[model samples]
Target: MRRTTTVWMTGGLGLIAAGVLGMLRDNLVGSAGAPVIAAAAEILAAAALLLFAIGTSRESSVVARRPLGVIALVVLALWPFATQFIGRLLSPSEPIGDLAWSVFGVASVLVPAAAGFIAAVQIARADTVPSPWNRAPLWVFGLHVVAWVVPQLLFAAVGADDIQGLAGLFLTLGKLAYLAGTLGLGIVAVLLANRRRTTTVPVFQSASTDRD
Candidate 1:
């Protein structure tokens, strides 16, 4: 792979790891853990943005026309906005003791719920490229959305205040799905990077060289 391609690939994987670790920290970490989790998520999201910018830059060697490339760009662009939207949606002025628990409801759960649908549509399109790993991530990530979102929506719609009661559930199951999806995405990123790299390789022999 070209140096640029390697950088993009590495950066993307690192972002994926950061996002996953952030979700864990946000959900599992307590008062002491808050800053660390939030910081990690911020860093990951920032790295994703940086890599996306470089990948989308005119100077980047990777072709933007490819389907996976397009999806990666779109995902990176939307990720931060999704997190911001969730933060706004969940913000409580009074700051209940367990209120910090709701962060997963928006961050881990809702954002993926929306993004998974978007990814599914893109993957299903006729013009989109196909790969076993890419398709798996698309589907699995979409499913992870369900795993994370349903319980939170159920509890929230009922106006349940026992956030502690559900905290463990969301922290365990919700985070598992979120981490899985992020890891899957990282795998897809690597695959896409490899595909992008191989696309540039030239055939060593001409078609006419084959024996009759």
Candidate 2:
């Protein structure tokens, strides 16, 4: 396999592993090692994001050519670490710290959401990637944002206190959707790598000698 393909595959698998770790952490909540598991999940996620960002930038000049897009991808990749740093620096129990964290938390979501959206659009526009598959980023990131925002909007509109059970249901559904979207991104990455491998032809191979 080509070096680029290997990078893509490794990054994709890393994302899948991170998602599984996240699931495990969620299930192990309240257990003795839950904090450890959660920390592992975050670390794995950050590394995976960095790898994926590198792979994407390598694959498409569109992403690499634009400074803003590249910056967004780097920011997205570093988000997990940023969150961890903020958590350590600020005590959530204090009112000022809590407010600071609240603002940062919102930025954590919004900034990444915006970055992902920009990356997805750029990837979709790049001719280097195949049609339809190029659009996979949109499905992965767009669904995530939709899943996150819809429930909050609905809960606010209906008044969370008025329908607590409904609110819980919405929250649960949103989490499930988010999980699905996360897994979907990994799957899409693997598929894209496979597609590239199957479609690519080595420059050294002549047309007559090249096998289908």
- RMSD to the true structure for each prediction, in A, is 7.2, 3.6
Instruction: Please report the TM-score between candidate 2 and the true structure.
Output: 0.78
| Superposed model 1: Cα runs more than 4 Å off | 1-4, 23-28, 31-33, 49-54, 57-112, 123-130, 149-169, 191-212
Best by lDDT: 2
Please report, in order, the local distance difference test score of every candidate based on alpha carbons: 0.57, 0.69
Task: State candidate 1's TM-score.
Answer: 0.53
Predicted candidate 2 versus true structure: per-residue lDDT over 116-184, tens digit per residue: 888778767766456776687777776676777777787778875766767666666665655654566
How many pairs of residues in model 1 come into backbone collision? 0
In model 1, how large is the Cα lDDT of residue 111?
54
Best by TM-score: 2
Q: Tell me the number of clashing residue pairs for each predicted model.
A: 0, 0
Error of 1 at 98 (Å): 18
Residue 70's lDDT in candidate 2? 62
lDDT of 1 by residue, 84-179 (tens): 675666545656624665655545545545655554544444232344543654676656667657676968775677666766776667666656
Report clash pairs, candidate 1.
Answer: none
The Cα error of candidate 1 at residue 51, in Å, is 4.2
